[model samples]
Target: MQYSVLGTTGVKVSKICLGTATFGVAPTAQDADRIVGAAIDLGINFVDTADVYGNMPVFDRPGAPAAADREPAEQILGRTLRGRRDRMVIATKSNGIVGLDINDRGLSRRHVIRQVETSLRRLETDYIDLYYAHDPDPDTPMEQTLAAYDDLIRQGKIRYVGLSNHPAWQVTHALWIADDRRQQAPVAAQVKYNLIDRSAERELGPACDRFGLSIIPYAPLHGGLLADLRVLDREVSGDQRFQGSGFSESEIATAREVERLSRAWGLAPYQTSLAWLLSRPAVASAIVGAETVDELHANATAADVELEPAQLASLTALADQPPAFQHRAGDGPERPPATTSSDPTA
Candidate 1:
């Protein structure tokens, strides 16, 4: 595995960050152990989990077996990471539905602080290397959230602040406040960025560039659509990973073409898709999740795949064509050609 500095954070992490959404959702405790063990064995030291990523939700459904444990992802990681926590950068998020209580969710001052404590307890770690606001909370003031994060930093509860599923304008405003208020600035952001959805490139991409923040894209494979377009035939429309969205016929065809094009380039569709994503500017890491070590290894090894300039340009040109639905596109800087600085660290 190749390592890259996580956006402005001095700490270096693997290009392929291991996402733990599958911990209790898919894999058994033994399976989770092997997957994490395989990741560490492969030099992937970045592991991402969420406070809400428990067995409560499985395969996009909310009805997990009552016998399953809560916060299984973190609990499992805490158990599996014994004597090895120092070697990895552990990231987890809050602001999602973790309970039925009124204060169980959101990025409010009370919730952020409360959730971090719970997260720390579950992970069996005192300090989170990176803690993210899972999503924006319109109910709470941004200042309240930022101030809470500031407190966490001072207390050494978390080292870096990041956000996910935030709009570009909101992120920009938060950055401005952090700088003007003299608070610890956010070091990274996450968004749904993939070959099929370049919407993030329009605003979040450029915004991160201006703020010197890293963009960690989740769902690089569009929740298995790009992994294998054939999965679409299964008709499992509500796979939670797709975020309540499904690909159109045209989108499927486009994904198929991308997969076919990859073989001509001597790579799997997933590998080619990941390589293209990693080559883009502003990307610090691509978070991929899997139930088994073999599946994880297939996606993680894309770090070794590189496309020639011409091949990359060809792929970009193909993607430039409008997709089935009006995919989000807006004014922003053009993505620079892939280069050595894709994950540059100082």
Candidate 2:
């Protein structure tokens, strides 16, 4: 497997990270064991999960299953990594509904502190390699959250901080806050980026590039739309993203074109998809999920597939379209330059 440094950190992680979002739901506990074992055998040392994963029923939905009946993804992962926990760069997140209490969620100091302890116990680990604020918490001031993360870093509870599902402005704000406070800042970002979704490139990509933050893209397959070309001809059921609504017509058409290109290049659809994502700027790794051991092996091999420059260009042109505003004949007015001071928050 290939490896890359996570942002500016000295530590290296596999280009393909094993995602455990489907751990307790699609794949049984036994299946998880085999899949994780195979991932390690294939040289994948990075794993990503969230406290809210594990296919649990909605905490607030009426008629939902009792809290005791839930099976958190962390618990399943903890059991699977009994003796090999130290061999992986494990990442988990907070700011998700883990209980029915009003204070059970958000990036508040109380929630972050309480959840870190809960995650440690569930994962059977003393410290988390990377901890993320899963989503933005507008109610809680950014300083309060960063202060909590800084304290955790000083305590050695987490090695690094990351942000997920946050807007470009918020990401920069957090970085500025950390810099101003002389606290540890986030070194990476986890977002939904793939062949079908290039939205991250709009502003998030440039922000990460300028701030030295690595982009660890999840859902690289677009909910399996790019995994296999055959899904086009068959019915898609039980899919987490496209189960009920189904894929849009344009999305299917794009997948079909990708399939044709993959055939011409003599490569699997997933390999082509993953290679293209890895080639993007500021991307440190792509998180891929699998239901079985064989599936994991197949996805893991993408780390070695390298596309030709011409091939990469063609695939990129398929999805990376410029904004409509840029199509105008005349150039738009120039914008003001960003802050040049050492403290961007100033």
Candidate 3:
């Protein structure tokens, strides 16, 4: 497997990170054990999970059980990594409602501190390699949130800090706060970046480049849309992400184009998609989840598939274009009031 430096940190991580969002949900605990074991054999050293990932149905169903009542992904991972904890760079997040208490969510000092303790216990680990604020909390002051992270680092609870699902402005603001306070700054940013959605390239890409942060992109396959375009033609079964209505026509067309290009290049659709993402600027790793050992083996091969410059450009051009927004008339440089001054010098 190819390895890269995580942001400006000296730590080396595998190009592919094993995502555990589906653990104990789609795949049972036994299935997770095999999948994780396969990832280790494939040389993947990074795993990403969260406190609220194991019980995803609760968010969709109104009367579903509370998240705390379900077995979280962290606990499943803990059992799976009993003898092999040191072999992976573990990353998890907080800021989601995991309990019924009013103080159970957000990036407040209380929530952050409480969740870290719970996560450590569930993961059976002394220190988490990276901890993320899963989402931005507008109610809590950034200073309070950052200060809590700084304190955690000093106490050796988490080695590094990261942010997920936060805008570019908020990311830069957090960095500024860390710099001004001499606290532990974030080294990575996680977002839903994939072949189908290239929105992160608009601002987060540049922000990460300027601030020395690595982009760890999740959903690199766009919920299996890029993996196989044929799913659009057939009736998709068992996959909750595409059960009700499936993808939009435009989305399907985009995936079909990606498939055509992959065939022309003599590569599988998934390999082509993942290779293109790994080649993008500021991207350190792409997180992929698998339901079985065979699937994990297939996805891990993308780490070694290097695309040619032309191939990379083709996939980039096929990505969904960002929505257009007209700039206000006065936003740009004025035309010098119709250039009434005749002199070129004027």
Candidate 4:
């Protein structure tokens, strides 16, 4: 039930953000209701969704599923929000695919404007609490993207601006442009961060702190890598939805430490992983997707689990190895300025 302000936006969000990449699929509206309802019961007020998040469990791949198969995650989430709109902080992204046309994607002015309007309609809301540029769109100039967001803020279509899967330099660069131009700067940055994957800590973490931008880490469980790696050895259920966060030799080494610490703390590996993420700097919230109501409740209760300072240090030291692998997006020192039609944004 703990909460923190989203960067410097003065908006309070739950420590655990409910990620809806699995919506409209396995955990359909009926199951989604149970999961989201449990999250609300446990005090989760932050929810993250992307326009191209339907049909599958995750969206890190590009163009495999046709446009017809991909349903907007926002639409599914929007329908579920019905009366609970005011009870949660709603966040959705653009710069992803809504159609097969060339102009249906990217962070260009035309695309951003058109996407936001459609998102507003599909979300069944006049304003989105937070809006994100799904990823780095190199084709479009940064100023054009910022200007589009600026207009949205001015028009009351979106309150705060943010980015997902954007690197440290790109974030700082955008902030520089926004500050210099007196435009609305981003309040948050979302990335694939978890106990097993600490790449964002190298540069993005420091940049976020310096720019007064909070970090909303998606895939906080590392595709169930932090959830539990036993499935790698033994054929365990619930490993399908988490296949995106692949495993590696070094990652398994760190995950072993996570299990040991979890045992000592008397908590599940997933819960311990989430608690560790909540303890990081500039981390406003950590987004975790749950398949069932029980899973949702378990993940939400991680907010109450606090690791001792020494314990956290030990966990960090174990996870401080070289980048072995990443969730869906490979661990690269520099992520190219790329935004795809399949914005699973997981």
Candidate 5:
């Protein structure tokens, strides 16, 4: 596995970070353990998860059989990493209105402090290497949230803080606040990027470039749409791609075209999509979810799928279209290119 510096932080992280959302959500603890071990064996040093991830029911239902032993997701992950804490850069998030109480969610000082303690306890870690505000909290002032993050850094509870699914302006303001206040600056920003999605290019992409924030992109393969036609069909039916906002029919067709190009290039559709994502320097890691070792191995091998300039150009041109909302002069559907951002609160 190859590695890259995470933004200006100078921390070396694997280009392919293993996302743990699937680890404890559907897969049993034993299965999740094997997957985590497999990821480590493959040299993946970054793992991403969230407090909300633990609460997701299997098959998206309200109540399903919990993974073996019925442990919460974070607890299972913590148990799996019993003696390997220092071996990986673990990142997680907070900010979901988990319960009906007001303090149960949002990025308020009360919530951030309370949640961090809960997260550390659940993950069996004293300090979180990276902490993220899952989404913009309209209820909480930016200064209040930044101060809370500052307190964590000062207390050594979190090494760095980041924002996901936030508008560029908010991210920029937070960075300035941290700088002026002389607090720990956000070292990274996680967004969504894929062969079918280029929306980040407009604001977040450029913002990261100017601010030197590492991009931990999720759904690098458009949540399996670019994996294969069957998965693409399932994704369309499920409306879970693009951070669960679903995709246009034209977007689905465009995803299929990307898959066809991958076959023509003698690569797995997923590999091609991942390889394309890795080519960009701003991306610190692409968090890909997998259920088995075979799937993990296939994704890990994407590091070797080098694309020539010509092939890259062809794939980009084919998938590069305006957002579906745009209209064309000739009256042809102005299918928008695929674009995904960090997972927003739904």
Candidate 6:
């Protein structure tokens, strides 16, 4: 498998990150073991999970058919990575906002501190390679967030930090806070980027490029849209992704066009889509979720399939239309202010 540097953190990550969102859910721990084994066999050294990954709370109730309230995925991950934790770069996320109370949800110092210990205990690891704030905390100030991350880094709880589903401006501000506070800054950003969803192309890509932050794109297959050929016919198979995505008819046509290009290029649609994502220098890793061992094998093998320039161009032309807000985020640029009382530079 091919590897890439995870932003400024200097960690060499596999181009395809193994996503465990499907782990320990629907499928048992044994099924997860098989998938993990396949990923490792393919030389995938990066694994991504979250504190609330498998806790599928249906109908807005906390009591879902999950393994447990906390430490479910981590326990399985630790058990699976018995002799290979050092060789792999492990990452997990927090701030899922499941509870009804306010303190249970944001990137506050208390929440971060509370969760870090819990995660460490669950994973049975001393330090996490990467810890991400799963979502933006609108109520918490940037300085407070940075301060919490700073403490974690100082205490050696988390080695590196990242943000997911956050806007470019928020990342910019977070970095500014890290700079001013003389703390560890987030070296990566995660967003939904794939053949079906190129929304990150406009703002996130450019912002990460400017800030020296790497992009770890999740939903790399548009939630099985490009992977499953049935999506070409504008039909979804009872997946939550379809319920929330609100994909338009035009988007469906574009996906079919992408499928057509895949045929012309003599590659699978998922392979072409992943290869296209790998073509971008800003993307460090593409997180792929696979439910079964066979699916994991198929998705992991896409890294070996390289597309020619002509093929890349054809695929781009087929599905490169920018959305309504592409130029807005790119055009409005700002330098975040320093966040300390005593400025270092005179």
Leading candidate by TM-score = 2
Which should have the higher lDDT, number 3 or number 6? 3
Where model 3 places Cα greater than 4 Å from the true spot, the runs are 58-70, 233-239, 242-245, 323-346
lDDT of candidate 2 over 1-346, digit per residue (tens): 9999998888899999999876765566567888888889999999999898875553222233344565788999999999999989999999887778889888999999999999999999999999999877767777888899999989989999999977677788888778877989999999888887888888888899899999999889887788785655544322432223557777778788888999899888888999999999899999987767877888888899999999998888888463321211222332322343433545
Residue 219 lDDT, candidate 3, scale 0-100? 84
Off by over 4 Å in 2: 58-70, 232-244, 320-346
* Clash count list over all predictions: 0, 0, 0, 1, 6, 0
The sequence of per-residue lDDT tens digits that candidate 6 reaches over residues 123-186 is 7788999999887765667678778888888899999999887777777777766787688889
TM-scores of the models, in the order given: 0.87, 0.89, 0.88, 0.87, 0.86, 0.86
Residue 46 in model 6: lDDT: 94
RMSD of each: 7.3, 6.0, 8.5, 6.0, 7.5, 4.6
Error of 3 at 312 (Å): 1.0
**Model 6 regions more than 4 Å off:** 58-71, 98-100, 231-247, 324-346
Write the residue-wise lDDT of candidate 1 on 6-86 in tens digits: 878788988898888767655666678788888899999999999867555443434333424544678888888888899
Could you give me the TM-score of model 4 versus the true structure? 0.87
lDDT of 4 by residue, 243-292 (tens): 53346777677777798889887888988889989999999888887767
Backbone clash total for model 3 is 0
Give per-residue CA lDDT, model 3, range 1-346, as digits (tens).
9988999889999999999886775466667888888899999999999988776553232233444455788999999999999999999999887777888788899999999999999999999999999977767777788899999999999999999977787788778777777888999999988887787888888999999999999889887888876555544321344233457777778888988998998988989999999998899999987766876788889999999898888888886675421222222331211221222334
Q: Rank the candidates by TM-score, best first.
A: 2, 3, 1, 4, 6, 5
| Candidate 6, lDDT over the whole model | 0.75
